[model samples]
Target chain A: MPRKTTIIGILGILLYIVGCYDGLLVAPADRFMGDIQRIMYVHVPCAWNTLVCFTISLVAALGWLLSGARARAEGRAWKWDELLEATTEIGVVLGAFLVVQGMLWAKPTWGVYWTWDPRLTTVAVMELMFVAVLALRGFVDEPVRRATWSAVVTLVAYVNVPLVYFSVKWWASLHQVQSSPSTVDPAMVLPLRINAFAVLFMSIGLMGLRTQLARRQRQALLGESDSDSTASSGGAA
Target chain B: MTGVMQGHFDTVLWVYGLTTAGLLGYFATLLLRLRASKAPTSGQTRVSAQNPEKTS
Candidate 1:
């Protein structure tokens, strides 16, 4: 990992701690939900970060597809493949976090551990789709083939992300509509925004480290293939 | 339901506890994978030395 990303990660963690303190102690309890409303601080941030990570994955997937096509046409590098792999993995982790946090919030607010609410169901589907993309990577042996297929699948799966976001608006569900600075209390907004930015920075930092790891893994695989081919040729000679 | 206090302190604690644990666990796993990737294992060193062009 890069020194800059590590610094950003540390800063993000510090901000998150401050935001948690403010959310838990400083912000007044909600009139309806009381102290349980504090769950919004972490839950909302996880939800937003999950979407952001998936968005990054979508953009990287598109980059990979386009660059891959261009590489075939003009014989160039496919650096975006590394990015696609990294972002998808990071997105999966964030998506998993989102589900767990949402579940925790739902149990108290909705009186059940889970329900088939449209928003919840849509988010679950989106998470599973991206997870399938990760699984796809492991099964493919050829580098180019794996990258191409994963990118295409990701593009198809990305259709669910927007649906996850708009599900509350599009359908009547137990989940609340998207909260904004206007809808939420001004005092609550500060900690929520702070945690949002904290998670955002942390996601970027994790993605950077993951992308580097993916690059290294790819290089190692290529080196192994190179040695294998050379050995075969030497044996023939 | 409006303007009624629902003191669910247990819920708040559970949410915070679970979220913190999940985030920390994920971060630890990522760090471990990164460390393993960076460590100069014998196989990786041999591969890197063999394929000079791939390193850069």
Candidate 2:
């Protein structure tokens, strides 16, 4: 790992620990939800970071498509393709965890393991779409073709991300509207903000590391292909 | 902490425990993968020639 990423990750972990202390021990329990509301420290941050990761994935997808087209025309390397793969993989993992965390929180608050409410339903759809993106990449053998197809698919699927965010406001649902500093108590807000930043920094570090790994894997695969082509050509000669 | 609301500490503990475990596990896996990718291997030079992005 890069020194900068390592520093950021360590700082993120420290901040998260402090935030957990504040949230789990220091913050007063809610009048209504009592200790159950403490789940927000984890649940809300996961929800927010999941959206953030998918948004990064969407941007990376666009980058891949545009850079790929340019690479074909100008003979440039396709780093964006590697980035798209990395972000999509990270996003899918985070999205799945987001759903699990939501379910955990929901069980305590809503008294159910699952609900087909708008927000929940939309997020589920979004998660499935990204999973399909990963599966789609696996099906395509050609790197360029896979990159282009997945990029287009990612853009198409990203339409649901905003839908998931606005579902609570657009339609009547069990999920609460977006939480803000104004909506939550001052004491509660501090820990929430701390945790959010911590998670964000940690996510950035993870994505950087993952992207590096993806690039290395792609390089290794390309090397094998090159060697095979050279061997076949040498045999013909 | 007078008037501190009580009850459901178990719920709080579970939430924090699970979240910490999940995130930490994920981060650790990524770090391990990164280390594996960085290890020098016989195929490393061939790959470096083909894709010169230099992930370092």
Candidate 3:
């Protein structure tokens, strides 16, 4: 809702367009996979952004817990809780994008749409775990309890995040190990990096908007609760 | 073996199309939720249950 957030989000959309153009037209096609390799530009960026968003959620969870008690008394804890919800939602969206993109690429390159590859499997697990955290939030009604429980569950789900990154290296799999400038063609790296930054900008913007929405919703709930209590007390008087 | 040698333009198109559409859809929903939250209502409690963000 903030001007800065909108600017960054629109800027990200612009960058995504440019990045896609570069990947689709400027970057050379893979000799093996041909034009299908272009999917890597968006696919790799989504993967990186998904991890980044989840990492933000992890940090937000820690913030909520570490600043507990005193922060709660000071009424400062909701900021962290709001952030946790925001980033977790965005992370889920990006992770879903990452999986679907991976599947689309796999269909042509690996002869199938779905595979039990190590990295792929771990990524799926990671996405599901974070999604469960979101569902946990929906089930809990109390503000403090929802924040506390989701934070704890986030901590548990975060264990698989590292595994997702390292799964390819630690196991024999059809998926390639992490890509680097040294490993990938130099030309491909530019658009890939562009999309990476684009997605990061977009994530930050979306997170800010989401956190703002949470704050407004909480404020409305608290207002309603206050009025209800006041009305009951007035009736008793 | 020859799977990688076939036409894959459609696959690439689908990847980009789906991701772009998904992210945009999410952004639109967030914007709508924000607007809904800002909207003043008489039975304010119903906002959470019916609204999209549902961060209650």
For each candidate, what TM-score against the reference? 0.85, 0.84, 0.87
* lDDT agreement with native, every candidate: 0.76, 0.76, 0.83
If ranked by TM-score, best first, what sequence of candidates would result? 3, 1, 2
**Comparing candidate 2 with candidate 3, which one achieves the higher DockQ?**
2
A60, model 3: CA deviation in Å? 0.4
Q: What is the lDDT of candidate 1?
A: 0.76
DockQ (CA atoms), all models: 0.47, 0.37, 0.32
* Segments in model 2 whose C-alpha atoms lie over 4 Å from true places: A68-77, A224-237, B1-6, B35-56
The CAPRI quality class of candidate 3 comes to acceptable
lDDT top scorer: 3
Tens digits of lDDT, candidate 3, A1-237: 478977998889889999988988899888788899999999888888899889989999999888746566555667788899999999999999888888888876778989888998999999999999999999986677787899999999999999999898899999998876668989899999989888988998898899988877766655534223221112211
Model 1 bad stretches (over 4 Å):
A68-78, A224-237, B1-5, B38-56
Query: Tens digit of lDDT per residue, candidate 1, span A5-122?
Result: 8788888889889988998999988878789889889888888888877787778777756653435333233456677787787778878877887887777777897999999899
lDDT (Cα, tens digit) per residue for candidate 2, span A26-53: 9988987788788888778777888888
Give fnat for candidates 1, 2 and onward, in order. Answer: 0.66, 0.56, 0.56
Which DockQ-derived CAPRI band holds candidate 2? acceptable
Which is superior by lDDT, 1 or 2? Answer: 1
| Comparison by TM-score, 1 against 3, better one | 3
